[model samples]
Target: MTDLTPPAKRPANPRFSSGPCAKIPGFSLDHLADAPLGRSHRAAIGKAKLKEAIDLTREILGVPADYRIGIVPASDTGAVEMAMWSLLGARPVEMLAWESFGEGWVTDVVKQLKLDAKVQVAPYGQIVDFTTVDFDRDVVFTWNGTTSGCRLPTGDAIPASRAGLTICDATSAAFAMDLPWDKLDVTTFSWQKVLGGEGAHGMLILSPRAVERLETYTPAWPLPKIFRLTSKGKLIEGIFVGETINTPSMLAVEDYLVALKWAKSVGGLQGLVNRATANAKVVWEFCAANPWIANLAETADIASTTSVCLKFTDPRITDGETFAKAVAKRLEKAGVAFDVGAYRDAPPGLRIWCGSTVETSDVQALMPWIAHAFDAEIASLAAAA
Candidate 1:
């Protein structure tokens, strides 16, 4: 029997949006008081802040010493476009897409770049078989599909001795999952996803091979100043350090630094991963116990721990899209959740962010509200019938 009573308890923090996700627990605007407002990003203090962000990121993610990490303009999308424009024409390209973002990359490579790239895509809840992928060609893929709630379990499928570069979009996966730096020649992420920091800035990490590609090959098309990573066939060392191509939000940079500090206080990479894993487990367990709701991912191993997607599985759901939206709406109106709706391009469902910044207790509180919302929606459906 479905319980229509609203859950007595509600999540303390109702932010479950996948991007611009919830801030670190106990976050405060006052934390950004030290931000160098009205100062040039090229100023000494600003550069020091930027360098600290890079160093802390490397320390937390365990990126190799030889790999160059840069703070770039725009977010993860810009980082990806920069890499594609700067490095892809050097070799045969293979684009693997499982979700909307990945598909966007494929479109750019084929339609925009006019590259005769090999494209492989899987449905929303499933991932492409890595065994079928030819790593000999430069490979592009997202480590985790934020929209589809699917992720690559490990880098075991990629060969370490591959001739081509592996460019990975790890926006939602970085700081929350284990990334194999050796297998990835280029990796991109933004501070807004897992870290719950301000957006408009992207982090670009490059292996030695990626730098070599930048120095050795020039693309067929004209490179935008923002996208260019090399000058006179030499890699731009300044970008890899603290110098950015454009002015950045010093306030945003400070917020990221604070988030990074909080991350270290908890336990660094392992701690963040554990927090996200625990938060996702709450939802996974709820789905396991409820027949009406189920994880969108086809398999548990590939299921995302960050953007945990879910769908209604009840037989009574005639209009899946409408029903899902109604449920999400009820939860929002009840003040139990907000921005829990699925991505615009994804199938109708809820996308609850279970990133490191989210507390497990809040996720537990959310589960009962979800049940209440589902039951109320079902009752409304029956009444209409």
Candidate 2:
């Protein structure tokens, strides 16, 4: 583990990382002490808290009354995996991959499950041609690819009469965007993204059709205890009602409950979206003023309001990888932000999470430091030149 030693001087402004982003303003560990500790997850108190989180998720999203929501394992990754393993084997599947996370789903199809699947892929800065996906086949996509900062505007591209289902990994888009539930059959996200809670729990929401599929079609492979979606060919009712198949972190559950309460107080889902949009606009305006900085995803309309990605335009720093790493290192050293580097699989850029939990003023304060970080690296490169 890295040293937790206090720095000689602390950053005047708080840092903003993409995932495990900033927490709700004024949040503290003191609140966590009151969380129902040492309580059995199956106990009435634990169940009541977990149930509250589930209920709040539905209320904030305005999910259809017929849909079922449950807490799952491994955060967003686990929620998506659960849907894939439990619901995909019986159908002809169409997988759309635009960035690293979407590509992960493709890997799950080809390598892990080894299913016969048709894959449509797009480069990092662009979205897949929505018209190309055969709605007749089971469709899988990421609502917002966290790495690329690109997303599909809506599922209107999905044909209305198609017999297939749409499964979406909406890890980064959940509460920040209007998810068209009529078109999505399975939706997955995590508390750590828009919710700003600790990780290790995934939220899975299934449409009526998804539930039907789980009850009717069984995967040929033997599922591990955690991946099983049904019991004796019947969808387990209690799991969706705060009963988990395996043990989960009660502390994490409590944190999620607190997040849900905060979400409700801030005008629920719409408020969350507003906060992210407002924060992203600050970064976008900064990019407009600084000629050296531009968005990796071209088109402001398509830009992500949650993860604002920035690319440097300096030809002198042609190797975006080197420039981005150095800038991120400098920012970390300054204690202005940590983990601001582009994802390894992505082209070099700064990816900042302008999520609901982040304060717009903090983003405003941090922008100058981002410029300083870039300037320091560029100056060093020039000295070497």
> Which ten contiguous residues of candidate 1 have the minimum total lDDT?
1-10
Residues 116-160, model 1: lDDT tens digits: 999999999999999999999999999999999999999999999
- Residue 269, candidate 1: alpha-carbon lDDT: 98
Which has the greatest lDDT? 1
What do the candidate models score in CA lDDT, each in turn? Answer: 0.95, 0.85
TM-score of each: 0.99, 0.95
Output the worst ten-in-a-row residue range by lDDT, candidate 2: 1-10
Candidate 2: how large is its RMSD? 4.4
Q: How many steric overlaps are in each model, in order?
A: 0, 0
- Give me the displacement of residue 181 in model 1, in angstroms: 0.4
CA shift of 28, model 1, Å: 0.5
Clashes of 2: 0
RMSD from true fold, candidate 1: 0.7
